[model samples]
Target: MSAPSDAKHPPPLEHAASWYAASANAAPARPALSADVSCDVCVVGAGFTGLSSALHLAEKGLDVVVLEAARVGYGASGRNGGQIVNSYSRDMDVIEDKYGAETARALGDMAFEGNRIIRERIASYDIECDLRERNLFAACNARQLQGLKAHQALWRRYGHDQLELLEGKAYRREIGSDRYTGALVDHSGGHLHPLNLVLGEAAAFESLGGKIFEHSPVVSLVHGQTVTVKTADGRVHADRVVMAGNAYMSGVMPALEGKSMPCGTQIIATEPLGEDLARTLLPNDIAVEDCNYLLDYYRLTRDNRLIYGGGVNYGNAGPANIEAVIRPKMLKTFPQLKDVRVDYAWSGNFLMTLNRLPQFGVINDNVYYAQGYSGHGVTCTHLAGRLISEVMTGRDERFDAFAGLPHLPFPGGRLLRVPLSAMGAWYYETRDKLGI
Candidate 1:
């Protein structure tokens, strides 16, 4: 494997060549914005957050237009591990300790709401993204296993009672490996084809009269009573604007630049393991993530390919060879797959914040934004959309709960933030190895 480097960033205006993209449901090319358009709301970025917000707003009878830098699900929303992990990057216990019980209670109440929203969309719109149930959190050591126990209790306190604990080798029934000391299973947590999910949502949005312009990257935002979102070839004027660009919104909004950083992660899919061999790797067909700060996550795709991913590349740099970086991690988890050939390897970026919580608030009162999911975008992005839509519709209580949480910039600023975060990750990784 090549040493990590900071010189690379994902090319704009296209989806990375990934297994998700290859197997994705057929999606038509949406025309780029070629002329000025007016709408009640113009959403920047057509990933999960943008599409979810657009669909919700359209359901509320608002005219919405969405602009995308590339195709739908082109960013992390399309290429993530695809596990529907519940809650935020930093869990509720951290929010409670740092923020307060009231703030935590409000945030916790809606932690799993995103999963429900996804299911509703899939059922209501007939989105076929290979929806499956159950997500397992594996603990590589006893210390991490204790963390899972505490996590289970914490979720139970939030009225989430769908957890089941497996001690010692009991988790092997679900994970099919000896690397884990224990695991906590969430019956409601799940996985699906992320790209197809976003594409399906985009279609559902269009079905509700919402318009999307792919390949239309926002160049500037002029905010006022009426907001103007400008692209190179076209512009959009709307009563309000939603900046759901997340990691890919670079250079569009100066105000949000230093608030978060983009970090990349690698994923690889092994050639079809076949149903029998796939079952040997993940016995219960459930998605799994370990408890380390920089954790590994894997699952069996609908077609029986083993989708494995781990390792972080701060500063959004693509590794020299994604397969080289991740193949070892996968083999470490399931050494029996030593001979399996990898069919796909790719990387994607998610926005990260200093405090590991999502950043939510408005810019100049009318321009709204939700980003900095900090590696937990799968569920949180959908929640962000609901909160953004609710606030736009005049209900602000839930959204305020998140916006009230302070998001500090990295201590070292842009020049040093990447290395600083990488050092922190290394420290945590060491502790994980030592079972501290």
Candidate 2:
């Protein structure tokens, strides 16, 4: 572990536009990386991590250039469930059971800080993304209910006493659904407009004079004292580079492409239900997630639309008709939504490592990367960016904790991991049916 330094971490520059492009706070697009450029750092992927690294480093007056294949926020950072959740995918108790209480405490603390990282950014940066402070951790079954109970107790041991375990009417009141038997109300976690958040940070990064190139996909990198980042139309000479592409950097970096598998998550936005029905649907406007591996995450959009996310698939192929695939899932959760029209339906990929914990670290000290937040990218990516910035300068303590967690690459390599995962998913679904 090294001390946090003041170096900028830049990736390959990209040039283009996106949905975020349509709604970015103040996007003064920069010219493409047309010629060989020299910079203190180059960042790849204008998503949370890359934009954030650029922001922090440029704040320190470093010459930073960010590269993205598409426009910023085109990847999982913009498409996630907007759940600013704590704890890694393995859960706190699993960490405690396998690693011990001390390590579990560190894990919980990091996750808790992941929430704080977001809150601090919203306030400090004045980001307006329908920010809220309600998070309902739900259990779909009694068995899951017990696990949440244990999870609450373990988190409490870490001094998070404010976490409230709600059941019965309390759970019903916290969320509008009786389908969930119990829930943990994490007042600290919340929901937000993710694309806006990423775009806002990009604005802040530019404010500090960071250079950005859109539609600039990094085709190759030559590593040495100074990293040579080559994009199709341009090149960058920098002391350090950061890969923050997450699920979108397909084939850009050979070593990272297969490390994390991408799974498609679908969402259905109901036509405006009005305050009356929206209040009945989710009175508290709390973001919710179930305990099932394939979970349903939903929240009321600022305009009173039920933004329901569900049906995760382990293939690159998106559901041809997202409305058709998600409407049934929504109706199952809220039969009252039978008459509700799904105004918008979309699906996006979320990368998940086999270990279930997020992957963050310096593939090389001068070259850092962060990904595999599972479905918890909103807040985790913020933390990832911060830590990667720290690693870029010299700090390495916090980054090491996450990097220390073991991550196993999918077996059968590139050719068959998807099929294997799909088969395993079917088995889990079958078990769900058999009550196993």
Candidate 3:
């Protein structure tokens, strides 16, 4: 139940205490890297990006080694809302408007590819992460409902047609809450147990002759033709390096230091409500997220527990009491859960960029990294891994589309970035309240 002492450079540890941790399948501790190793590619962090990249590269007959700061799926990859939401944090319309139609077309083509990869990996590897179908985007006000309409239209323009609009009492067919004015159901989007998925992917990667050293936090990278990735106990000399560490990484690549900031979100799981009540709460048993600037997302766990999560801390700082911060929000949506007991509460961090899109680029022609997934790491991270692998294998067209996008350092640097971003969030949140 111990928290990570250093958020940026978390020490080697077990998974955070949460519902996921309690129900996680058995996984033995991986050995720490104690001897110098050499490989075709050395990936940092065993979360989604690293595992996905390692698995893809391993399948391509390359020798891949993954080093984890903690256990597999230990970061946001393991702890997110588990919804397979598509698209980047900044959707395609914004990309097209800001970067141009060519960039938008390139990204739109792969908007849903990440979730597709998730399902494919699950079926191909027989991963049991409680995969489910359909996800709903709920709207609390007329403005947000109209926004959902535009969102559906925007997604359709990108060729994703598995959507249906629901309004009035129809919302109850999906979510029991009366808070939503309408909802958009994405038949293609879904949810699953995140930790199990990544763990299974890691096992699948190892099956392909990939090696992962847990408790091996990379302390520094000596970049050259052959990158030397140094950890506390060992070093990995490789032809290429994948810095897939995301938010938990710091001080390794100074060039990447100020471009993104880590932010925390909290989640709480209520005691099992049993099948009937659980079904009543989420009649269709799909994940649902509100359409707010700072949104709330929840889903019924396989065990029937309501897992609700929301709220953000821009500075990567977590609330002193997670349940205290989130319980009221849960009650505001589902007051019927007045007497329900919270069985678990936990917090996790995700890297955020100024533009809200993921930052993908290579360092020194060999050190490739894809981070700053903002709040959309679940699907994007998987896609990033595939793209990183593809680019390394000489297929850079799709990779360049993402890498070509611009990412800038936060305007106020580390010290003021948190407060500045907080102010922006507050402004948007106020607009949400005013139903703008």
Which of 2 and 3 is ahead in TM-score? Answer: 3
Best by lDDT: 3
Identify the runs in model 3 with alpha carbons over 4 angstroms from their true place: 1-11
Candidate lDDT (C-alpha), each: 0.91, 0.77, 0.92
How would you encode candidate 2's per-residue C-alpha lDDT over 255-349 as one tens digit per residue?
A: 76667888898877778899999888788788888777677888877778888888778858877888888788788778998988877767788
- Who is ahead in lDDT, 2 or 3? 3
Q: What is the C-alpha RMSD of each candidate to the true structure, in Å?
A: 4.3, 6.3, 2.5
Itemize residue pairs with steric clashes in candidate 1: none
lDDT of 3: 0.92
lDDT of 3 by residue, 347-432 (tens): 99999999898889988899999999999888998899899989999999999999999988998898899999999999999999
Candidate 3: 10-residue stretch with minimal lDDT: 2-11
Q: Candidate 2 — number of clashing residue pairs?
A: 22
lDDT assessment of candidate 1: 0.91
The residue-level lDDT of candidate 3 at 159 comes to: 96
**Stretches of model 1 off by over 4 angstroms after superposition:** 1-12
- The lDDT ranking, best first, is 3, 1, 2
Q: Name model 2 segments beyond 4 Å from true.
A: 1-26, 99-103, 433-436
Sort by TM-score, top down from the best: 3, 1, 2
